[model samples]
Target: MSDLRTELSTNLDEAAWEWLIPHVQRDAVIVVASDLDLLDVGVAIASDNISSVQQWIDQQLMVKPSNTQVGNWNSDRTKKFHTLILQPYVLVQEMAA
Candidate 1:
């Protein structure tokens, strides 16, 4: 866990919506549920724990941001989200208000 944590920690970052536009443009953004540990999810995906990721996806806990969500973010240029990259997908979780 330490090594994986170290590797993932380096990739963990906070990003504004504008910085993520490229990923969104490519339809590579995934919105992770707030209840889940963002790092844990990254670790799971990084380690290829497909069953865990599949379960989350099946339950709709992980998904692409809805149009409403994108609309809101588009309107608020200053908003930021916790983000992580897992190859083709970039996982994002909304920050607690």
Candidate 2:
């Protein structure tokens, strides 16, 4: 887990860093799930401000394609290569808690 955290922090591009730092500081869990040809970095913001989350996602897409992949993987090696698409949505239940 620590290694994965380090890799994410180190490999994230400038745009990612800029968008992620504040969320991270606010205790959001940022998960980077990937598939064969797409990387979906979801930010679980614990807030009701859905617009803010969407804006952040839009900013990231402006810098690069939202469906961009981080690396190449052989399809044969895995059954399904579907990753969690980075959709910034407010987890209302979690937020209420």
Candidate 3:
């Protein structure tokens, strides 16, 4: 396995760090894909500071409801309510190297 390191500097709280760290570490590719009009906004928000990203994520998660049910309703309903958003950052180093 390849080990990747990403450092995020933001004003986000410790809780946000707990949530985001694992996702960033597991992601193989980070893609910034959004509409042109939203590009500037996205980049600006993403680059502003770590706190900004954390706040955005927290807000998104707040509005979204989690689906823990398992059954026929699990797949379809779960997909409709899920959201994963993040800013793309360059891979700075590989610890396994």
Model 2 steric clash total: 0
Task: Mark the regions of model 1 whose C-alpha exceeds 4 Å error after superposition.
Answer: none
> What digit string (tens of lDDT, one per residue) describes model 3 on residues 28-57?
212222222223323445456567546545
lDDT scores for all predictions? 0.90, 0.30, 0.30
lDDT of 1: 0.90
Residue 41, model 2, lDDT: 33
Best by lDDT: 1
TM-scores for all predictions:
0.91, 0.22, 0.22
- Local accuracy of candidate 2 as per-residue lDDT tens digits, 1-97: 4454444344333232333334434544233222211222322232234775466556553122122221211212231222222333111100111
1-97: candidate 1 lDDT, tens digit per residue: 7799788888889999899888888999999999999899999888889999999999999999888999999998888999988788899998865
* Model 3 residue 11 distance off true place after TM-score fit, in angstroms: 26
